[model samples]
Target: MAAYPENNRTWQIIHNARKGGYAVGGFCVYNAEGVLAVIKAAERCRSPAMIQFFPWTLHFHGPAFIKYAAEVARAASVPISIHLDHCLKPSDADLALECAFDSIMVDGSMYDEEGNIKYVKSVVDRAKDKGITVEAELGRMEGGEDGLPTIDLESVFTDPDMAADFVKKTGVHFLAPSFGNVHGPYPAGGAEKHWRLDRLEKIHAALGDATPLVLHGTHPLSDEMIRVGMARGMVKVNQNRNVRNGYHEYIAENCTKVELTTLQVEAVEAYSKGVERLMVEVFDSAGKA
Candidate 1:
């Protein structure tokens, strides 16, 4: 295993990437096998990357796994940071921070604007005390548990002025503003339905260049859209569902010929290669880390 990123190492990388007009990869990992693959890929590429675990992963695998994976990654000399992704509540985020995660993203954009600000400020205050980075959401992500009962797409777009105000009040290190970006895969050559570049530019204009902007649900976009996002103040790109599916497909294709240990080993290898490929090809994050 490679060494873990130093404390504050991940945020610094993210900050620098923003300055350089590139997005750093924030690959999601749900288990030890996934962690190994993400770290190995980033190490081989000589890139700084983030490994994130959803709160539900802890329910299935328990918190010990998260700690163990983080410890192993830290030991490796690679600039790898562990983050708790899409924490559903403040308590879950508090637990992750206490567990020594370098960062936690609070997804409270589902609330009313005022409620969202209050929730973010509370989390930011708690995380900053530990020197942990906090990422707050501005616009609600539709069709997810992160949102309220409303499923209307009309409620989805972010208000640039409101987003900037939320940041100013909360003092979060990064912001994930919904600019028409959605969670699932898109149709073939789809009209890039989600992620309005103009909206992103407006938000950037409002928030200014110092803030690191993260584009969630980044997988469904075309290469052109991704490049446009990078050019417009997006510093971190999250790729969870795409990479997981890629790894599973690789495993299914090659599993029939392998023994148990070999199958597990091959799956890890394939997953690691897939991640490296995403870093180099899809995300254009190679050498930016």
Candidate 2:
């Protein structure tokens, strides 16, 4: 068997969450403050965390920024890992593999099942040598996040049995299944009306505890619904706009009133507060460091 999903920082934190009956938040970040916010929240709550960056950051902030984020996160008292989210292009995956990230979400959802498996398997093969675990999205998620592409096609739910086969074939450490979960905010009905917990349950059952489930499309998901996903085996919950809104609100309100340094400090605090709440209340990861 491959030595992947075993020794890496991301794998270790997530594995601990799995064993401890809790979930770690995959907090997506774009800048230095975003990095600090996650570290602050994880340390304050004593929770394990994954600081995620989209592929845009790779080109915008560059690899040095990713290394800085990883350095900062790894230095925290709590268990924190740096992860590259939604590496859509194989080239981006290639670039991410050379960075300081502890994990990379290899998104092959745009491809056919066989193509996705082959693509993910290729990255997984290379990632093992770099000591970085990999996360693979099995089905296409509708809508999009800040840096991800918006797919006009309907959301494709992941097949439970196929998820297992994909995991086995690709040697992926984490699985983000699309089961009625869109990328952005839900339509008229909220996540409560759209999320298919039954499908998630089946996927979890198919993969068991060996492979962790990642909850995506969680912008407006209720705390109760989040808790329900955890019950069904979502060990890593991806939080993008969900936790960063507080930071945005603070920045918008205080940009003209406060000094740049002061604004950044307080803004990070606001972001951390949002992350800390989830760690303490919903994820049950606080004090699990």
Q: Candidate 2's residue-wise lDDT over 1-289, tens digit each?
A: 4365567889999989999999999998888998999999998888899999999999998999999998888789988999999999999999999999999999998899999999999999999899999999998898879868899888899999999999999999999998888888899888888888889999999999889999998878999989988999999999988888888999999999999999999999999999999999999999899
Candidate 2 clashes between residue pairs 3 or more apart in a chain or in different chains: none
**Which residue pairs come into collision in candidate 1?**
2-76, 3-75, 3-76, 3-77, 4-73, 4-74, 180-194, 180-195, 181-195
- What would the per-residue lDDT of candidate 1 be over residues 69-150, giving only the tens digit for each residue? 7797787666788888787677787677787678888888657888888887888887777878888888876544323243
The weakest ten consecutive residues by lDDT in model 2 span 1-10
Q: Each model's TM-score?
A: 0.89, 0.97
Residue 61's lDDT within candidate 1 is: 80
* Candidate 2 residue runs with Cα over 4 Å from true position: 1-3
Alpha-carbon lDDT, every model = 0.76, 0.91
